[model samples]
Target: MSFASDNQSGASPAVLNALMQEFSRNGTSYGTDEATKRAEDKLRDVFDCDLVAYFVTSGTAANCLALSALGDPWGAVLCHHQAHLLRDESTAPEFLTNGMRLVPVAPFAARLDADAVAAQIAAMPDDRPHNIRPQVLSLAQSSENGQVYTPVEVRALCRVAHDAGLRVHMDGARFANAVAHLGCHPADISVRAGVDVLCLGATKNGAVAAEAVIFFDRTLAREFPERMKRSGHLLSKGRFLGTQFSAWLHDDHWLDLARHANEKAQALATALTSINGVRIAMPPEANEVFAVLPRQVCAQLGAAGIGFAEWYGDAILPDKIELEREILVRFVTSFASNETGVAAVTLAGGVLSR
Candidate 1:
């Protein structure tokens, strides 16, 4: 009944098998091996673009490097105030970009609308000599709030950023789930929608430590290899990542894993909606469900050994009267989630009501 995080899950069987197969053979190092080439080719086919793809160990590296490719030391990358770059990555983006700044935008949803994005860019004076030039816009698909953006929404955001003379980057930490939830081809949400770069996430889905930095505009990533190599992210045992990603992309393995996870989340959301005193914080999209559980409900779940994180907020009511306080538990279902696990969580929540 653990709704803590998808990261808590293990690698899928198929991904593990692929890694074992690679272990049986010797390969070149630093992304020059056969496995690496196959992974890159598979990503090009998946995104349906002649994009430059590089595999990295973690999502943070993918994001920082992708942004670094779009900016110089004095440039700025704009993203949602709660974006991983701003709130979670511990300043790696700034460091990787050689002191490039991350400017936070407002309107407060995990997802940023086109107008809010435009307003922030327009507010930054273009003529200031000392100001960090606005160079990139990074958005999270299936945003931090667990909301998924449709194809049109992604394109609209892209159009705004491009018009502002900024390249767009997507922190696709949940790329597989977003693709599966939208039931659209990967290209529709990325290259075709004007995204210049994307961090194609795999760790949070099913792979062990596989993540890819996909540059849809090849011209924008000319110096990325140097950036990656210099950062110590260029894995000498690179085929390990490649082996996992290849298995993830082959025969829609990634999508299949994502679909299963999303299905579990959807079922959990449906069950929660039926429970009294529990509020749905965000509609279920992809594999994450955010909820506002009553105080007693939260305590009950906690007592029962179900794990989750409190969603960020003041956690205090405006008035002297203490309201429910709205605990935001992040319920993440992975490909490994089974019917029994889902049902167990549902029953636990039901205990709060009784």
Candidate 2:
């Protein structure tokens, strides 16, 4: 049983088949391929907007490129301290934005409220020569701690960011999962919610290695192709990237995959909740569940060969070795995470109790 990460899961059959089909026909190279254009059109249709969606190789590229569109070298991108751009990407946002600084705002879990972002921008000394001007506010949809910001929350943050003369960028790496959990229209958390740019993720959902950089403001994406090229994220066989997104978006397959993953996570959460000494750490809003498990139970589960992460957190009761001290563990369910895998972990928990 593997609860490692959604990225560890294999691609969906649909996406694989689409990739094969693209390989079958002779197509143009780069992003001018027919499949690439089709996928771009599909994204515009899906989002119900005229903005162009550029296919990229990974979510990092999408986010970095999107940020590049919003920032100048002297500008700063404000994001939650725990955001992927801040921690995971290892300063790719900075590299892509041409040496722009990333000024992390408050919220340890990367869930930023609108006012906090605005307050920071307001506090910045714009007249200072050395001070980096705040240009964009990047918020992760389903934040680092597996908590999702509601559509209303997104709107509020966007409003605040824009009013402070900053564009809004959504790190939508887990966006499909968030939308599935909330049961809202995609636009509700995107353009309608005032997002200037969205990094539409596909790799984690079901695609092999694909992500899209969608700019709601067409003007911002004008020079993005150059930025993507310079960052080495522009794939030579661009149709491969397009094919996956095409299959993912076709007939709402992306939503289907994400919803299945979220449902499995819910099932896992329910099972964990029923076990003694197993407490949920911040209820899951997406496919990720954070649970607190007893040391014995954790050892028991690990011994049984279930794969998961012991997330980083301060030990509340370090000396209580045998007691049920809180240990935050991240359990991520993916499209391929079947009932058998879920049962394996939950049943192991039961066995540990016995």
Give the whole-model CA lDDT for all candidates, comma-separated: 0.85, 0.84
C-alpha RMSD by candidate, in order = 2.4, 2.7
Compute the lDDT of residue 96 as modeled in candidate 1: 86
- What lDDT is reached at residue 86 by model 2? 85
Question: How big is the positional error of residue 347 in model 2, measured in Å on the Cα after superposition?
Answer: 1.2
C-alpha lDDT of residue 309 in model 2: 88
Itemize residue pairs with steric clashes in candidate 1: none
Give the distance in Å from residue 198's predicted Cα in candidate 2 to where it truly belongs. 0.6
Off by over 4 Å in 2: 107-110, 314-324
lDDT of 2 by residue, 166-257 (tens): 89999999999989899998999999999999998899999988988888889988977787788787778998998898899999999999
Please, what are the lDDT tens digits per residue for candidate 1 over residues 1-354? 787889889998999999999999999998999999999999988887797889998999999988888877888888877777787899788788888898877655557889998888878876767676788888898777787889999999899989989999999999889999999999999999999999999998889998999888889889788888999998999999999999988999999999999999999887777667776666788898887777777787788877777766632222222355546567888988889877777787676557
